[model samples]
Target: MAPSKPIITVVTGTGAQGRAISRAFHRSGKWHVRVLTRNPTGQVAQALEMEGMELVQGNFEDKGALLRVFEGAFAVYSVTIPPWHQQYDLSMGEYEQGVLQADAAKASNVQIFLFSTLPYVGPHFMGLGGVELYDG
Candidate 1:
C-alpha cells in the first residue's frame, strides 16, 4: 500500500501568495494541503475547498486559532501582508505576526516553518529614490 501524503498548513490561504503555494503543493499530489483563512465563505477559500484543499477558519492574531490549525501538521507556510496593504486591517506589526506564527508552529511541533518576508531598505536608503516596501 502507498504511504499517505504529509499534511502542510498554509497561513493566509485566501491571499494570492498563499493560494499559489497551496496550488503548487496540490498539483504535486505529494502532500495534503490545509489552509487557514479568516473568511471561509470568501471566494478564494471556497475555490480552494473545491480544489481539495482543507480550509480552517482562523486569524493570525488569535494564538488559539493558530495553534489549532498548526497542530499535527508536518509543515507550515506562513505569509503576512505588509502593513501598507489596505486590503487587510493589520492590528499588529508584520514582524510581530511573523514571530507569533513561528511560536505557534513551534508549540504545535510543526517540522517546517516557512516564513515570507521583505527586506527593510527604507531606512538604509532614506533619500535615494526611497521606496518603502512596508512601513511598520
Candidate 2:
C-alpha cells in the first residue's frame, strides 16, 4: 500500500508556539496542519482558517471533544499551559489535561505524537518532568 500524508493536529493552537508550528507545517506542504484550540471562532482561528488550514475547537477538560479532534489525524502536538501563572489555585490542571489527552490518543489509533514542553536542565529533572510529553 502507498504511504499516507501526515495529518498534523496541533493542540493548544491558540498559544504562541503551537500557532507558529502549525503555520510552518501548513507552509511546508509536506503535511496537513489541523489547529486545535478552545476558540475556533476566535481571532487566531479565523486567521488560520483564512490560510486554508483545518481547525477544531475543543478543550482538554472534555474527553469526547478531544477525541473528535483526534479522529483521523496522524499525529498530535500537545501543549499544556500552567495555570499558576494566572494566580489560579488549580496549578496542576495541566497534568489533568495531559491525562485526558493521553486517553484520547490511545483510543484514537493515533501515531507520531509530538509534544512541545518546558526545558529540563539535566537527566534527573524535577517538577513536571516532561510528563506532558510522556503522557502523550
Candidate 3:
C-alpha cells in the first residue's frame, strides 16, 4: 500500500532544528515526515513520534541506514551534528557525513534535497566552508 502524502526524510530528527522542521511539516498535514535518529527512545524523539511523525532509528555514520530512510521519499532534509568524541574536529567528519547523506538522497532518487550543516571555518573558527562543498 502507498502513503497518501509525499514523504520527506529528516536527518537527526531529535535535535532542535530537526524537531522544528519536523513539526512544521507535520503541522502542514501534507508531507509525511520520516525522521531518522540515533536515539529513538529519547524524549524529543518520542514526542515527535507522538505528533504523527515516522521515527526511525539511524545514525549519520551509516550510509546504508541513511539510504534506507530516504527510500521512496519525495524530499530529504539533512542536518549534521558535530561529533564530540572526534579528535580532529567536525569539519572533515561533518562533510563526510553530508556526502554520505547526499549520496543516499541521490540513490533514493529524491526530487528535493536540503542539507543543513556547519561548513569548514579556519582552525579556530567553526567548520563553515566544508559544508558548502558537501552541500554542493
Candidate 4:
C-alpha cells in the first residue's frame, strides 16, 4: 500500500507554542495539519484555516467532540498553557483537560503523541490529579 499522509492534531492551536508547532508542520508539507481550539471562529483559527490547515472545533471538556476530531488522525500534538489555562478551570480544570486529552489520544488510536510543555517551569501531567511545583 502507498504511504499515508500523517494527520497531525495540535491542541491549544491558538496559543503561541501551539501555533509555532503547527506552522512548522505546515512548512514541512509532509503531513496534514489540523488545529483543535475552542474558538473555531476566532481570528487565529480563521487565519490558519485560510492557510489550508484544518480547524477542528472542540475543547478538552467535550469528550464526544474530541473523539470525532481524533478520528483517523495519525498523530496528536497536545499543549496546555498553564497560566492562561488556570484561568479557565481553577487549575484543577486545566489539569483535568490535559488528562482527558491524553485518554482521548489513546482511544483514537493516534500513532504518535507529541506533547508541548514548558521546559524550566516543567510539565504538568494532569493524570496525576495533584499539584507539583517547579523552580522555573
TM-score of each: 0.83, 0.75, 0.79, 0.75
Residue-level lDDT tens digits of model 4 in 1-136: 3226788989877776778788889889898888888888989889988988888887656778778878888998887556554434533344676787788989999889887566223244454543445322
lDDT of all predictions: 0.85, 0.74, 0.81, 0.75
lDDT of model 2 at position 109: 86
Q: For model 2, how does the per-residue alpha-carbon lDDT over 13-117 read when each residue is reduced to its tens digit?
A: 766778887888889988878888778888988898899788888775678988988888888888766764342234347778777787787799888777655
**By lDDT: ranked, best first:** 1, 3, 4, 2
Give lDDT tens digits, candidate 1, residues 51-133: 99999999987899999999888999998767876677888888899999999999999999999865334554445654555
In model 2, the clashing pairs are none
Poorly placed runs, candidate 4 (over 4 Å): 1-4, 83-94, 119-136
Alpha-carbon shift of residue 80 in model 2 (angstroms): 0.8
Best by lDDT: 1
* Residue 105 CA displacement from its true place in model 2, Å: 0.9
Cα RMSD for predicted model 2: 7.0
Which portions of model 1 miss their true places by more than 4 Å? Answer: 1-3, 118-136
Q: After superposition, how far is residue 99 of candidate 1 from its true place, in Å?
A: 0.4
- The Cα error of candidate 2 at residue 59, in Å, is 1.0
Candidate 3, residues 1-136: lDDT per residue as tens digits?
7679999989977776788889999999999999998889989999998988998897667878988899899998888767653422344466788888888899999999998874334344444433343333
